[model samples]
Target: MFDLVIRNGLLIEADGVTKADLAIDGEQIAAVGLSLQGRREIDATDCYVLPGAIDPHVHLQMPLAGMVSTDDFRTGTIAAACGGVTTIIDFVEPKPGQSMLEALALRQEEAKNKVAIDYGLHMTIPTWHANAADGLKEVPAVVEAGCLSFKMYQAYEGMMLDDVALLRALTAVGEAGGRTVLHSETGPVLDYLRAEALAEGHVEPIWHAYTRPAPLEASAVHRAAELADLASCPLYIFHVGCQESVEAILQARSRRIDIWGETCPQYLLLNAEEHLGGPNGALYVCAPPLRSVEDNRAMWHALAQDALQVVSTDHCPWTFEEKQQPDFTRIPGGVPSIEARLSLVHHFGVNQGLLTLERWVEVCSTNAARWMGLTRKGRLAPGYDADIVIFDPARIKKITPATLHEAAGWTPYDGMEVCGWPRTVLLRGKVIVEDEQYVGAPGDGRFIPRRPSALS
Candidate 1:
């Protein structure tokens, strides 16, 4: 006998969708086909049973820039569960005088007994540490510790890596069979632009976007891709928001490089203009600050053409109260989207005819799982984990914090109309979300260990 059975739902596997019944035994799929019996049964007529989304970019309770995000693992993962995400891979920023593995362990303790869903972490190697020089040595230890990916930043010069150090980290990924993800803004150029903007009294939130405009990003992308190619490393550029960045990725691909890019909903939906005309638009603030409307359209085109491989939330949550804390620079730097990611993508991309339903699942779920190296986590196939989402393609709803599960208590996607919503979310055969509410327990999340990439 199975533990749970989902009946009469159209299953969306990697290839396509088809009618099927899924059976679960403990934490894995026991059977899939027709009329399977289990202790519990879900009637899923007219709904799509898809693999639970694996969001590879999320910052829950992450301390950054001086303030910590308001969403802890409990709230963040609950929000993720309600939105049909099965697994979340967050970052572990190493503190001064800490080992990278020790840093990950501390983060795991912080998340333990608090998360409502499964989670994994990427180690952010700060440049100014002896540990960074020790990066090649620590790669194997962390990979063996279930943390397989490492992130390097270019713009946070004092904190992130230098290009030489960046190259060393990339070569290390090749050595460890691990993957590398980067925040590709060029720090020196950004510092120059910021200095220029400040000297000109461009303190407005919109000016933030203008300050770190496309050329800096374009130059950074071109350089970062070249470095990755030189190391023959599989590099992923995170939250790309401009045309030149896309062009850089395409340029690298043309030269037979295996580099990838991920764009957020904000870049594909909102633009830099949202941050215009003083502090009124400050609520829309985020780093790499939102780009032009033309950039938005370009991002959509990239998604449609497969130039970008994943569409993730970058789901960093914060409250309006927290954001109102005087200096815009002092306030938090991220907006919440875990609860709205899948629906927003479906509404704008699929419902508006920009993306096919299959492509919606691909961008939001499958590709994210694959990119994050969670091979068995992104599809509703026979052998994969029963991480599933039952979504009503026609359910209409407005984005609002009234339905949010995060402690941040706000949504940047607020007040927008959307035409889809997740009905139930199952992670490892356990239904963590039901009827748009979270029912999972804290401590339920497990650290995800990734396999070394085959290409490496």
Candidate 2:
């Protein structure tokens, strides 16, 4: 007999959904067929059994602007588990003059015994110089250590890379069989606009969105795509927020460039004008701030059309008091959504007819795995890790900070009604969440070593 079995559930995969029984032996799915039995069984009648979602981006306890985000590895992954995420990919930002491998080791130390679910790391190229032989030479070793991906920024002051350096770094990573993930925003333009706004006495939260308008993001995406093409590198764009950026991805893919795009729930559901103007507006402050209603519509359409391959939560969070700043620039920029992504997407994307069930699974789980090289973590087939989520379609609730596991004191989606919450979650055949309450322990999670990107 198998170790455990989930019976009479509708199994949802990226390709299709069907009624089946899933059996697990040890930590892997043993079979998916009719009449499967196990020594221990869970009744899943009327539930949707899906592969646990994989959040490809998050920043737990990330330091920014002299303050660290509220959720650390332990709290953050617990929240993720409650929301049905079985794996997450977080970044490693090396200190100034630090080697990439050194930063990776330090980051692993921080999360070693704290994570509540499996996780992988992506090395961030803080700054790249053509003459910097030592830094570039570590790409292959880092990849060999199982990172398999690198992050490059085009917009931060100290972290941004110039075109030449970016191209060179992309080429180095490509030659090492790894993919390059980019944060596409034009730094100089943003600085100029923010200075103009602040000089004009426009210090409200709305100015944050006004200063970093959609065109800057689109232009940066276009530039990054061109550089990736020149380097023959596989590229993944993070937090794509507008239609112009979506069009840029479409154009690049039309030419057979190996490129992928991701959008977050904020860009898909919240609009700038409505969510960024009140006294509490600072709470929604985040980089590449929310976009217009038309942009939200465009984001949904792009996901449905497969122009965007992943929908991840850039799950960085700050406390409410920490966000209360006199100037918009002083406000820490990030919002918490690690525990809300799946339900929000299921309510707004699937229940509202914007995304099919299969498409939802693809964007929320399968595609992220395929692109990020988490080969065994994102599927429920035999021999794959038995990470699963059982969602109750009829469950409904209004969101409130009190009901969430994020250490942040508030949420951007407060009071929004949503359906289809995860009632059970399994990580490697171990039940970690039952009835939406996390039963997992700290240090139960292990580091996931990734393979080269499947897209590569």
Candidate 3:
């Protein structure tokens, strides 16, 4: 007999939707057929059963431009579970004097008892340091150790890689069986813009995005794509927002470059116009600051064209207290998103006809898993991990911090109405969230490694 059975639920994925009785044995899926018997049966009469979300780009806990994000692995992963995500791939920072392996080990130890679902780490190569060089050398072992990918910054003063090192790291990951991910932006140009903006007395909260214009992001996107092409490396651009950036990605993709781009719920749901509105204006501030509605429309079109491959939260949450502490030049650059990415996408995209249900599965779950190399993290089938969300298709819910599971205590998505919500979440066949509450322990989360692909 199967251990658990999810009955009468519609299985939605990249392929299509079908009615099935999905059975689970221990942690893996046991079967998907009619009349499956199990120790427990959940009647998912009108629910949608999709693979749990795999959030590939997130900063669960880490230093940012100045302050740290509000969510730790424990709180962030629980919020993720409440949102129906089962797997997360977050970054691990390098210690000033530690080897990449040393830093990675330390990070794993820290996360060992701090997560509520499966997790993995992406090594962020801070800059062109000797340790970065040494770290790149062990990437093969890192990949073998289940870390599997490297990340680079192009904006933070001390963290962004120089042009030569960026190209070199891309090439090294290409050769070392790992993927190279980029946070694209022109640091120097942005710095110049911010100085000019602030020197001329343009320091209002709304001026943040204005200081770093879309052209800067677009130029960096082109340059990064060129570098990735030069190295013959696989590229993944994190948190893509502007039209020009997406266009650059599309143009490169047309030439058959193995490059993937990601856009977040913020870009899809909020635009530059909101940043300039009201007394609560400071709430919308984030790096790659939200762009115009036209940019948002263009990004939506990009998704419809399959030019944008993934949708993620870029799930970094920060307090207004800490984020607002920076002067115009140093204000932290992120938004609160751990609990809102999926529902916002569903409310706006799926309901408005911008995304078909299949595409929703692709953008929110499947593609993220495929890109991050989490093999068993983003599907529903026999032998796949029983990480699933039982979604109520017609349930109407408002997004507010009052209902969040993240330690951040608040959400920027307050007051937004959604027609569907995840009412149940399972991680490796264990119920983590049921009826909108977390039921799992923190240490239950495990580390995930990418399966061999271009990273091989």
How many clashing pairs per prediction, in order? 0, 0, 2
**Which ranges in model 2 have alpha carbons more than 4 Å from their true place?**
128-131, 453-456
Q: lDDT (CA) for every model shown?
A: 0.80, 0.92, 0.82
- Expressed as tens digits, the lDDT of each residue in 1-456 for candidate 2 is 899999999999999998999999999999999998799999999999999999999999899879999999999999999998999999999887788889999999999999999999999987743337767898899999999989998887878888888998999998999899899999888989999999999999999999998988999999999999999889999999999999999999998988999999999988778988876889888888998999999999999999999999999899999999999988998899999999999999999999999999999999999999988977879999999999998999788998889999899999999988999999999999998889989887888989974543
Locate the minimum summed-lDDT window of 10 residues in model 3: 127-136
If scored against the real structure, what TM-score would every candidate get?
A: 0.95, 0.98, 0.96
Off by over 4 Å in 1: 130-135, 276-279, 325-328, 453-456
Better of 1 and 2 by TM-score: 2
Better of 1 and 3 by TM-score: 3
Give RMSD to native, each candidate: 1.9, 1.1, 1.8
